[model samples]
Target: MVAEVFPLADIGLPLGARVPDFTLPDARGRLVRLAERLRTGPVVLIFCRSEGCSCCAVRLRAYLRALPELAEFGAALITISPRPPVPTLSTEDEHRRSLDVLGDVEQRVFADFGLRRELSGEPVPATFVLDRQGVVRARHVGVDHGTTMEPADALAAVEAITLG
Candidate 1:
């Protein structure tokens, strides 16, 4: 069982707290900066276990299916993992097959976000929705096998932020 901790480090990113800006490479070694992406629209950042996590895989597939639609609102969905870089070909293919499949293996960014929660020998699953200004608008930390934020709910949150 996952122990409940008071003042969970990964819960409730405050409405006005600025998300620390970061530059992490995508699957193809392309650099992506939080500041740069925010210039266009809201960024939905998903920090998950690199690979081998079944829950992460399921979350990625769900994001992959929802990507095109999410793009309509100019919201960029990004998924990062601590998995080491795969071969160039495999990396590209994986990006095409799953969620953005772009992330850092060094865990620098992951550590910065405080998403690393060691539970039962596995890292906890976490999600953060950051507005264009870099403030975290929504946050979810899950310890369950099926923990994830639904695409529709995320989209609605973005829409509300944009319209407001």
Candidate 2:
């Protein structure tokens, strides 16, 4: 499917809000559509910092560890990074993650999701758990280099959406 990006004026994308669909390029250079993934199950959208951030790596590993369980519920985990480094870019190729480490080069998608970095321009962390209908179920937006949620906790949020 083609990319669908909802205008900021159209939807605020707050909690319990119906998320507008988006299309982004995965690490493998393939387009991933939010609407398409929602047809199968819920989605875990992680807005991460660049490769220079330490916690980004930790969070990636944690989520990767939790992927199997997330997939059991037919949920998908995706990371959106504005300007991910070379090594960080290889992560998907290295481990063959089931999810995409999408590149948001323009950060337009980032802003479309109602996200902004710190005053210093260092990317912050944010997580949104969306159900099959594309309505946001859970979310955590950080202020600085802070992380949003632990992988397991993120799974719990997704579970609440899927199982509840």
Candidate 3:
């Protein structure tokens, strides 16, 4: 049997594909379902390695800073990590409350989303903009370990989806 090869660009979920529904627990242990969030408006899904990773922390913080702008577009940010959620200090409570930090300890959601790195088996730092209908409008999957999608680009994707 011949092996079927997929192009490098097809490594992760393609644009226009409908994302599978998933339910993951947030930092506060509250269950957040993807389908439920879609009911409100567009959703920005971010997949990161771990909270301890400096790169991941930077990506998360950037998104946190863009939360207000994202809210203006009626888009919600949801971050998924392979490890269990660890509560942060009280100082970040307000920022943390704006987005949902989900824990996918089993990595099931990462696999389902096709964001797993082939070699490390870790979730690739990815940003997906899903419209209210659950269809992927834009996606950026990191090819390098420390690389992640920029907050402005993600917001632009959401803006386009919201506007168009």
Output the number of the TM-score-best candidate: 3
Candidate 2 lDDT by residue in tens digits, 1-164: 65444333333257888877788887557788888888888899888767567877777878888888998888888888897424343454335444777778777777777775323444446788889998888877765445457778778887887788
Model 1 residue 27 CA deviation (Å) reads 1.7
Task: Give candidate 1 misplaced runs (Cα > 4 Å).
Answer: 1-12, 85-100, 118-122
Q: What's model 1's TM-score?
A: 0.78
Candidates' TM-scores? 0.78, 0.80, 0.87
Best by lDDT: 3
- Model 2 worst lDDT window (10 residues): 3-12
Question: How accurate locally is residue 101 in candidate 3, as Cα lDDT from 0 to 100?
Answer: 82
- lDDT digits (tens) for residues 1-164 of candidate 3: 65444354766788899999999987678898999878888999988888898988888888888988998887888888899887662335345344788899999888888877666676676888999999999888875647767889889999998899
Task: List, in order, the clash count of every candidate structure.
Answer: 0, 0, 0
What digit string (tens of lDDT, one per residue) describes model 1 on residues 61-153? 777677766667677777777875443333443454323445666676765776654443344567777788988887776656377888777
Q: Whose lDDT is higher: candidate 2's or candidate 3's? A: 3
Worst 10 residues of 3 by lDDT: 89-98
* lDDT, candidate 2, at 56: 77
